[model samples]
Target: MSTARQNPLSYDEAVTWIQQFSKSSIPRDQVTASFSRSSGPGGQNVNKVNSKVSLRLQLDRATWIPPHALQKLKTSPLVNKAGELQTTSDRTRSQGKNLQDCYDKLIQAIKQAVTVNRPADLEALAKIEKR
Candidate 1:
């Protein structure tokens, strides 16, 4: 059981924890990121600077995540028509931050789908043991 905690875990921290538990490694090459100009205001200036970040990942190419987690990811809402997982971030003006935000979103989604409820999981396993 987790001990006392004060602050909530950040997305990157959660991803790290999940990675440790799953013994998985996320490959950077598998992630493709694109930057486009942020919309609204600044007309030509907006078109010139690419502040929005878009990220794409292929589920078929994912290998490090646990099988159960992969299965969950396949059915997740993050999957697109092309069977690719996609995410974006444009709220921030900084291109770098936007890119990181996109990555964080992807990680958080995968973590949520993969992470099981410990109490419920233990209960289910206990029932199996009785049989």
Candidate 2:
């Protein structure tokens, strides 16, 4: 449910965008997941099972994200030379858990990239100013 977005999103609007997408709005089709063997400790399972998750979302294909947030997301370090926003998680030995971790990381990164803090309004401050 991607909506039309302002070209330059204000802080409030960006917050709304994050809130909207934070919940399962990112289309699964636009994201690709790859699994690899994790190097961390987990007994024999670590060496044998492919528990690591590497999730990627191509910025261009992620139309569900607001335009301004997408622009900010493009500048994120997670974005690769191929223009894909990537997140990897091997903290857990379960592939499912790792995949969830990847989603959490992706969302957090998007939150950080999109959220811009607006300064306090001077007019509002003046109203509350003490003599």
Candidate 3:
């Protein structure tokens, strides 16, 4: 067995993580992103600067995703694009923070995607709902 720890977000590991984490049935082309000017603070610099980041992940093409994972993401308030999730930050009035916020959102999305539900817990919920 390999003793290596899986680092999903590492620069070198992005491709591998994408393959494993995303639904295999979905084509890679489905995901896309766009960048635009971030609002708030930074005076005149902010008025002319594009500091915000937007990422869109297409779910329709993602055939490999499990139903539960899809349901969770669909129900999530933060999710967009019928499946896309977006995050933005202009707290520092710097491009760096905006970029970091985008990355942070991506990481959080992956973690949410990979969450596993225990069978027993689900069964209990089902019983409670019936009552």
User: Ten-residue segment with the worst summed lDDT in candidate 2?
Assistant: 1-10
Model 1, span 34-66: residue lDDT tens: 888888445566667898888988888876554
Better model by lDDT: candidate 2 vs candidate 3: 2
Clashing pairs in 1: none
Query: Which one wins by lDDT: 1 or 2?
Result: 2
TM-score for predicted model 3 compared with the true structure: 0.55
Q: TM-score: which is higher, 2 or 3?
A: 2
In candidate 3, where is summed lDDT lowest over 10 consecutive residues?
1-10
Best by TM-score: 2
Return whichever of 1 and 3 wins on TM-score: 1
Clashes of each: 0, 0, 1
Q: Sort by lDDT, best first.
A: 2, 1, 3
